[model samples]
Target: MALDVGMFEGHRVNRAAAERRCATLTTRRSVKKAHQAAWLVNAVRCVDLTTLAGDDTEGRVKRLCAKARKPLASHIEAGLGLSAGELTVGAVCVYPTMVPHAVKALEGSNIPVASVATGFPAGLMPLHLRLEEIRWAVAQGAAEIDIVINRELALTRNWQGLHDEIAAMREACGDAHMKAILATGELETLNNVYSASMVAMQAGADFIKTSTGKESVNATLPVSLTMLRALRDYGMATGHRIGFKPAGGMKQAKEALAWQILMKEELGRDWLNPDLFRFGASSMLGDIERQLEHYVTGRYADSSRHALA
Candidate 1:
């Protein structure tokens, strides 16, 4: 699909309405006991188990890969009647240089390695260099590439410029899937968020991500609702579905349930899978693991028991 300003231009989002809708998504819909456990497990499958810290090391990435491989402990899996190695996160996300470590660590498993490229977190580098970064990550065996869009372009409403740059990055990704980070917090208005999401999808983004996990505000429900509206509109007109990922500041199993509920209600069960949704989280898994342990034994385990993730 080519860039089409007609799709999102002049689009307006009412913040109050969006906030009200997000509010009901949690209070009105509730999953308890077994149903809650099931949704949490689904959330585990959609997690992009990530380690993007500046102090990231090969050892750390491998450990994260190990967690991704066996997200649920054997005791918990047995209690749930799940087989060994039956559960795994959607992908292992790391810095570009750490992709090889994750790729090797996750070998012989179905999980894919994801790398944050295109000068991630800031994306302030020159365009040519950013394109090269994508190529380099793909060569390093990253099956998925997360690239941040230039906030300046979106802020100034330079749709053509934004589209061209993302298209170039997509070309550089080659065979790898691309998740375009909209950095919604910096985009100011919900209108800007919708327009940017539309532009990213039009430029061939396989997923429209909410943030890079670095912004002061990241992955708020109101902003995510706006992006999903754009995603739904795009799907309606073009019949091509795109994924959604909410990254940063999510650290509870209940938060996982909330987002999954949002996806199921707004986009149906189709978006409930890894192909259409992802949680770019690192610590959130710890809480989920703890909750599952509690569900199995009727006692909450110490946070340290599930702290590895």
Candidate 2:
């Protein structure tokens, strides 16, 4: 797929309307009691149980995999009317070096190991090195690759270059799904956000992600709405459904419900699952667990009960 420059032609986002919609999304929806707990469990299912840090270790990655396997205690899922094996995170996301650790730990459970590649967060490295990083991670058993787009291309208005780079990354992924991180915080404009989204999807990204979890600001509702609108337009134009992920700054179970409600409203209920949406977080799981505990026992579960920090 090539860049269709006209895809964004005449595209104009009404800043006020988008903001109003986001406000309504924030205020109108409320998931309570059993529904809130169910949505929290679904949030657990959609989480990418992540650990991306300067000092991530095999021990840390394996523990993350363990968390993904049984995001809640056996009794919690049983209380929620789910089988012990039914509750799990969407995937385990980690740095490429720890893919094997994640893969080994998550073996036989069918949980995909997602590795962040292509000079993640900054993406300032040379193209060959970045492409090689994707190949290396895939060869290491990464079932999915979360790639950072070169912001310079989008910033410089080099849509073709941006499309080409992402297309190459998508190719290198082979059988693995590719999540193109637009880093909305860095794109600087919702127009750029929507246009870059069109370009990423045009270039074959299986999922268009909002951030890399390393930005000063990340995954705000307005930016997400802009991206989801692009997804809606792209899907309607091509008859292909792409996934959306709101990464970073989403640390509450209530926040999870808000994103889910946005997805349902904008893209319909189909995208509420792990296949189409994911929360890229390591700490949010703890809050989601606490909320679930509150639902199950009528009291907040101490943070220490959940292994994640």
Estimate the Cα RMSD of every predicted model relative to the unseen true structure: 0.7, 1.1
lDDT of 2: 0.90
* Candidate 1, 103-132: lDDT as tens digits: 999999999999999999999999999999
Model 2 quality (TM-score): 0.98
Write one digit per residue (lDDT tens) for candidate 2, span 32-89. 8987887787788889989899899888887888888888887678778888788889
- Model 1 TM-score, 2 decimals: 0.99
Assess every candidate by TM-score.
0.99, 0.98
Clash list (residue pairs), candidate 1:
none
Error of 1 at 254 (Å): 0.5
lDDT of each: 0.93, 0.90
Worst 10 residues of 2 by lDDT: 26-35
The Cα error of candidate 2 at residue 3, in Å, is: 1.2
Off by over 4 Å in 2: none
